[model samples]
Target: MQLPIDFQPGWAPADIEDASAHRFLFLQGALVVLRDGDGARLPDAAYRDLPIGVLHSVGVLDGRACHMAELSDAELPEGLEAVPLRQLFNRLPEALLAVAGRAQQLLDFARSHRFCGACGHANELFDEGRARRCPACGQVAYPRLAPAMMALIKRDGPNGRELLLAHGARFPGVIYSALAGFVEPSESVEDCLHREVFEEVGLRVKNLRYFGSQCWPFPHSLMIAFVADWASGEIVADPAEILDAAWFHIDALPPLPHQITIARRLINATIAEVAPDHPALSVYGAG
Candidate 1:
């Protein structure tokens, strides 16, 4: 599924020549500053006087030049509040939320790559690109993205098509989502998917169909989602990874992840395709 945000990513110049027509995103750690108003909105040109450190361009957002900057422990001015990125998930438009995630990732990349690993020398930002170069060892560090896979397994049952949902040990409350795992070295996404499904639930799956991908910016993960058919074996939840695993009928699913997650999208799309007449389609199948 395509995100609603319209962003054109490009390299940022060393210095912004003009700040009047630009939109600034000020971040303190994982917290982004939003103007106190009717709704959550980034600080506009009026607040440009705030302290800025190591500014990075986050491309254009809705025809406006967007930039990101890290802030020190400076006190926020009146009429502005620093809000955590997680709290702004559904509060902001999907497009703005996505751009905010991108800004956060870029800020994180810049903060963690200040020094080189190979050599103990301090690194310098490239003049024309988004990378840090170690003059001593010629080591270049760019933004890091860990590719992970999300699989929504399904099977034919007496009731109808059943979805294999599992409650992850790390999930909040009783929320259940599709099985997911990070890709290892020299392993393709499909291979990782198969391994993750079996390792987590001890179930073999087949008929892998690619669904979509999302940039999950919780410390930086590119989630590739898929729909797979259960091939063999019964549910065997790994105590270390999964709290519970079970097959639920399409119309009788339990509480799922939030709409911002790709897992929710994958599940909704599969249900819409396999069970078009499902009563929940009108509410949850738009993904």
Candidate 2:
């Protein structure tokens, strides 16, 4: 996905040091408030008043230095609220949203890898890119992104093509989305796709055409999406992971993921392909 603003991606501190203005995303425990409740707000001056401290450099936004930091309860000023990271998706612009996700992953990396696994020594950010290095043992740790596969299965029906959508046990209400599962160790993404589909819905898929990718920063996941033709198998919703599964034509579909997500993009692309003149395809257009 393209960012709304130009962001010169880098991890080196020197890259952002010369920037004229600085914007920061602050995380209190695990949330950052994008807006205030009663329409009031916390200005950048709030952060500027805090004592001098090191800021994690995210990237330059329109020639200004954009940074992030993990804060404690006492660090937050009055009238500010901390919301879950996921809530910022629709609140911030596309470019700033991307930066927020990056900050989330970076903070996760920093918190988990504070000490070197090999030498048990405190780890520090490397001078250049995003990495943590140990002075004692020379060990380096980079941000870890778990790769996951999402498959949107489609099949030829008596009326027209239908998409196989499922509701996971985690979701509330009747929300349905493409089947997804984490890529196992030593397993290819395609292999993970087939295994997850068969295990979750007891189906076989073919003609796996790679669709696209998205960085889902709920925790840390790289979503690799694909459009696959449902080859065979009865719809069997695995009680463990899937709550329900069904095939729905584009004209009669269920609730889908957000427009910023790859699952929604895959569905939209498939709808456009099956029914070029369908109006639903344009309903959930890009953000």
Candidate 3:
């Protein structure tokens, strides 16, 4: 999906050596450091003196060079606090949030692929692109991404068009969101969506329509979302995957996902299409 920030991705180290460049500093555990002020922002020249272990170029943002730096220790230089990247959802602009996610994923990739799996040799950054090279075995490793599918099912109910939302077994609190699962080997995204829908809720769906995608950095995942119509089958929430599953009318809905997520966008867009004058539209600030 399109974000509101102006960014052009690049990986050359020489392009981001300027002291005034935007730097996304992260601790050992992928915690981002933000300047303490009116609103959180990525530290710039003020933190250029921190002991950085590694630095990776993350292209350009708003016509300025951007980079992601990994701090060797948790020591802060004062006026800065470390926070999880996910916690900056609404606090930072959408463009900045998206870029931060990219920075985190790139850092995670570099940290995890420090050694070659094939020869157990130390790996070095490849000069040509975003990859690690094993000089001993000629093995090259690139950043890995896991693709997942999110499906929002809808059908005409006695009251109106209702949506099928589920509280996943792993979900925190009582938040109910669209059903989602990862794509398995040798399976397409569409196949994964259909299989996940039936496996989680024991229901059939049809007329799949692509919604959009987001680069989720809970580790590294590309979430592809879609909307579908329920064809048949009764609600039988799988005890293994779903804590609860049901169809809710537009007016009466449970707590939804955060607005930054593609799941929320999918639900909002579908609701606006099905019920243009829905009061929920104004409540959600539907675009």
Best by lDDT: 3
Instruction: Return the TM-score for each candidate structure.
Output: 0.91, 0.88, 0.93
Q: Itemize residue pairs with steric clashes in candidate 1.
A: none
Model 3, 62-168: lDDT tens digits are 88877887888777877787778767766666777778788888888887899999989999889565899999999999999999999999998777889999999
TM-score-superior candidate, 1 or 3: 3
- In model 1, how large is the Cα lDDT of residue 249? 91
Off by over 4 Å in 3: 1-5, 14-17, 35-38
lDDT of 2 by residue, 1-287 (tens): 34444787767563324434444545554544536553322236445544434567777778766677666434656555566655555655666667767777877787899899998999877857578899999998888989999999999879988999999998757889999999998999999999999999999999999998888886889999999998998999999999989999887989888787888888988888867778887776733
Per-residue lDDT of candidate 1, residues 118-236 (tens digit): 88799987756688999999999889999999999998888788999999998878998899999999999999999999999999999999999999888799999999999999999
| Model 1, CA-based lDDT | 0.80
For each candidate, the alpha-carbon lDDT, in order, equals 0.80, 0.77, 0.84
Task: Kindly state the number of residue pairs that clash in model 3.
Answer: 0
Candidate that beats the other on TM-score, 1 or 2, i.e. the better one: 1
> What local lDDT does model 2 show for residue 120?
96
In model 2, residue pairs whose N, Cα or C atoms come closer than 3 Å (at least 3 residues apart or on different chains), thus clashing, are none
Clashes within 3 Å, all models in order: 0, 0, 0
Reference-based TM-score, model 3: 0.93
